[model samples]
Target: MKVRDFMIKDVLTVNQNAPLSEVLQLFVAKRINGAPVVDADGKLTGMVSDGDILRYINPTRQTVYDMFSYVFVSPPEELAEALAYKVETPAKKIMKKNVQSVSPEQDLEEALGILAKHHFKKLPVVNEKKEVVGVISRGDLLKQIAGRLNELNAKTVSR
Candidate 1:
């Protein structure tokens, strides 16, 4: 099987200029962990994930000396304040640019290799023009494997 055979043709994408809050809302509404960032022409530029959004909420590091010298250490509330400040920022600021992509015609083994090597959950399938046509996830491959296994079991039962 090839990537095109199992990939989702309709992908939910976000524009670079979209506000981070909108992006977060979309993720919640769609129940998706990430989205492909696309340009005005609908070309894949980057991707943003829930992990990237959560990074904004991490407390800024301070030197150990500063931690001891300060009258009060930064509290968890400070992290929330910092994240609130970034909620309206554009997607361009947080999207991952060095994305790993696959061609639609590529074999499933190549897709599996890419996913395994990078620990990626999904890969964007592109065309000759590098335009994203679909996306394939690890779950899709697993489902295909399960179907084949069931078929083999049926054949064995018949024999």
Candidate 2:
């Protein structure tokens, strides 16, 4: 099977200039873990995921010293809190640009290989012109497999 057979054509995308808060809300409202970020011409630019949002909301420790300092020092804690709050300022600032994309004509195994290698939940499906037309997720692949199994079972019962 090909990616086009299972990919979702009606993909939900967000503009690069969209506010981070709005983007976060979209994720929640759509019940999606991530979305492809497109340009004004609807060209794929980057991707933003729930992991990115979590990283922004949750401050990371720079080092053991920084962790200790923050724990012992009140100012560092305040600074960390302030920075986490600032993370909701914009989408362009937090979106990952080095995205891995797939074409609709690609085989399902190829798409699975890419997703496995990169540990991605979904891949943006781009056309020959490099414009994103859809997205394929792991769940989509599983659904396809289940459908095939059901068909096989029905055929066996009929025989």
Candidate 3:
């Protein structure tokens, strides 16, 4: 099977310059975990995932001084300020720049190899111009496999 066979054509994307807050809202509203980050020309520049957002919003860690045996904690106000700044930051700041994507004409196994190697849930399907045309996910591949299995089983039973 090819990626285009099961790829989702209606891909949802986010602009690189969009605020992290807006990306978070889009994630919630769309009930999606991540999206492709595109430039003004709709070129695939990066990918932003919920994991990236969570890491961005994570509060500053406490520091410990071994020699002085002193522990320094980040104040609530400082944490709040950091969060405020992070929310206003653009998605590009937190997005993974080196994105692994597949082409629509690529074989399913090739996409699966990329996904497995990267431990990614989904991959953006891009054209020759690196413009995102669709998206393929592990779930999509699984569904296709299941459908094929069912068809095979039906054929065997009929025989």
Candidate 4:
């Protein structure tokens, strides 16, 4: 099967100019961990995930390296205070600009390779115009495999 065969056609997408809060709300409402960011013409531009938002809003603590060991220190309260403004910031400011995508016609094995190699949970499927046509997730692939297995078992039992 190809990516287009099992990909989710009703994909959730976000606009580049959408606010971070709006993106978070969408994630909660749709119960998705990530979404592809699209342009006004519905062209895929970037991707934003819950992990990305978390990294931005709650930055990791600073690590100070000593001669013998590393000392981890918490971020200054001021830094946390500063990040509060990010909620209203545009999604483009925090979205991952280097997005990896696959064509709808691409083979499922090819998509699987990319996902496994990159440790990605989902991949955006694009058309020739570079517009997002659908999205395929690890769950989708698993479901397809399960269905095929069931079919094979049924066929064997009928023989």
State model 2's lDDT.
Answer: 0.84
State the weakest 10-residue window (summed lDDT) of model 2: 71-80
Tens-digit lDDT track of model 1 for 1-159: 888887889888889899998998999999998878888887888888889888855666653345556765543456667777887889988889889999888998899999899988878887887677888788878898899999999999999
The candidate with the higher TM-score, 1 or 2, is 1
Predicted candidate 3 versus true structure: per-residue lDDT over 1-159, tens digit per residue: 788998999999999999988999999999999899999999999999999998888877655445567666654446677787788899999999999998999998899899899899879999999999999888877898899999999999999
Residue 31 displacement in candidate 2 (angstroms): 0.9
**Error in Å for residue 85 of model 4:** 0.7
Q: lDDT-based ranking, best first? A: 3, 4, 2, 1
lDDT for 18 (candidate 2): 87
Model 4 RMSD in angstroms = 4.4
Model 1 global lDDT (CA atoms, 0 to 1): 0.84
Alpha carbon lDDT of each predicted model = 0.84, 0.84, 0.90, 0.88
**Segments of candidate 1 deviating more than 4 angstroms:** 61-77
Candidate 4 per-residue C-alpha lDDT over 1-159 given as tens digits, one digit per residue, 9 for 90 to 100 = 788898999999999999988999999988999989999989999989899898888744555656557666665445557467778888888889988899988898999999899988889999999899999899888998899999999999999
Per-model TM against the reference: 0.85, 0.83, 0.88, 0.85
Query: How many residue pairs collide in each prediction?
Result: 0, 0, 0, 0
Give a tens-digit lDDT track for model 2, residues 46-128: 99999987776665445334564565433334445755577457677778999999999999889999999998998999998
The best-first sequence of candidates by TM-score reads 3, 4, 1, 2
lDDT score for residue 80 of model 1: 68
